[model samples]
Target: MNEKIKNFADSISPLIFLDFLFESRKNLTRLIIYFVISLGLIITVFFMQLSYSDSSRAGVINAFFIIICTSSALIGGTYSAASITSEKEKKTLTLLRMSGISGVQIIIGKIVSGFIYMLALSLPYLVLTLLLTLFGDFNFFRLAGGLFMWAGFTFFYLAAGVLISVLFKKNASANSFFYFSMFTLHFLISLLDEWFYRPLYDYSSYKFFTNLSPIDVWVNFSSSHLYGSTYYGNDGISSLFNGTVPDYAVITLLYILFSIILTLFAANIFEKYLRWRED
Candidate 1:
């Protein structure tokens, strides 16, 4: 068992370490700047939330959700989408392949490294927000649910970015497509939810469409947890679950399935591309 564990670690360590070292070497200065900016923004928001009256705790929570969701989508998506394209542009991808790393290893390494960087940028702000929630009479379970939802969304964004990066040869093109798709999806969902579903109080339609938006999923689930069924026209906790499974749980499962499918698709494309290059 120990030998098997050691072998497994050895197989992956080089890929992870090399990717991390390369990223740090290339973007150390930019990373430092981003960290400073993110820290400043988080501190400012924390203080601003503190200034709000106790009665406005819900507003504060909503603000935090907005910040987290926007940052995760933008920063995570950009980094992940650029990870492979940047390597190809630098002409180092062939060198790595020549070193005997499989295409799967390359994809996995990029995804892992991108996820680490994303978390580094996101976790501090999330922790600060969680701490603030403690003083705002928020339920711990609700906060946990929100965190889980955000984490799942972040993973989905990273996976989508990776798939996009593999599809587009140029970093700029991949990034443009990624941002455009993300914004369009979010905008359309919000418009539909507000302009169509909300006015009609169409519970079925609202639930179906809003679940497509990660932001809405988080908001609705968290609101159900915090305010119970009374908050959403009697469609709350009970409405969130179908039999035994919660609506958020169903959404999360779908996201995970989609991510897995995208990753597999990217890996197949990458492998074929590598083979074609060799020929």
Candidate 2:
């Protein structure tokens, strides 16, 4: 078991290390820009929190979750999409392949590298939020759960970006498609839920569709878990899983499952693309 674990780590470490080096070498300026933006946002939120009343601080904390989720999703998606598309643009993918790096390795490495990069980008916000919980009337469990949800959402977006990158040859095209699809899906599904589904369908259906948006999931989860609200409790969806699960739990599970499926699909697409190129 130890030997197998060691072998797996050995296989992945090189790709992860090399990808980070490549990103630092090629995208250092962009990374610095993002880091500066994140730092500015964190500082702004900190001052805002200082002025909020005790009751309003919860709302501020909730806003932190949304900000993190949105920024991480957007940044992570762009980087993940560019990671592959840039390689193809520079024709480095072919060299990597010739150097005996498998397509699966490249895909997994890109995903992991993007995830790590986003996590680093989010660390400041995460730390500030945690510090806020010390003085605010916040539920620790809810804060932890929301962070977990954000991480899952980030993975899902990054995987989708990878899939998009595989489908497009140019970084610009892949990036455009990723951002458009992400915003479109979130807004379109949300509008459908609010305008058509909730007014016409049952709570279960409304809840399912609403939870499809990671932002909505985080908001609803924070409301129910932290504020002791019945926003999701009255819904019959909870009973479907033996009444032990919350809506966010179900949503997190679905996001994770979809992330795995999308990553596999991207890997398959990449392998096929490589074969076509060889031919």
User: How accurate locally, in lDDT, is each candidate?
Assistant: 0.72, 0.78
Q: Which stretches of candidate 2 lie over 4 Å from their true place?
A: 25-54, 135-138, 190-207, 233-236
- Estimate, for each residue in 53-139, the C-alpha lDDT of model 1 and write its tens digit: 654665566456656767779988998898788888988878888878777777776777777766776777777767678867666
Candidate 1: count the clashes. 0
Give the best candidate by TM-score. 2
What lDDT score goes with residue 146 in model 2?
A: 70
TM-score of each: 0.77, 0.83
Off by over 4 Å in 1: 1-9, 24-30, 33-59, 134-138, 189-207, 225-240, 243-246
RMSD of 1: 4.4
Question: RMSD in Å for candidate 2, one decimal?
Answer: 3.3
Q: What is the Cα-based TM-score of model 2?
A: 0.83
Look at candidate 1 and tell me the lDDT of residue 256: 72
| Model 1 alpha-carbon miss at residue 58, Å | 5.1
lDDT of 2 by residue, 27-87 (tens): 8898789778878877787787876775566666767777888887788899888888888
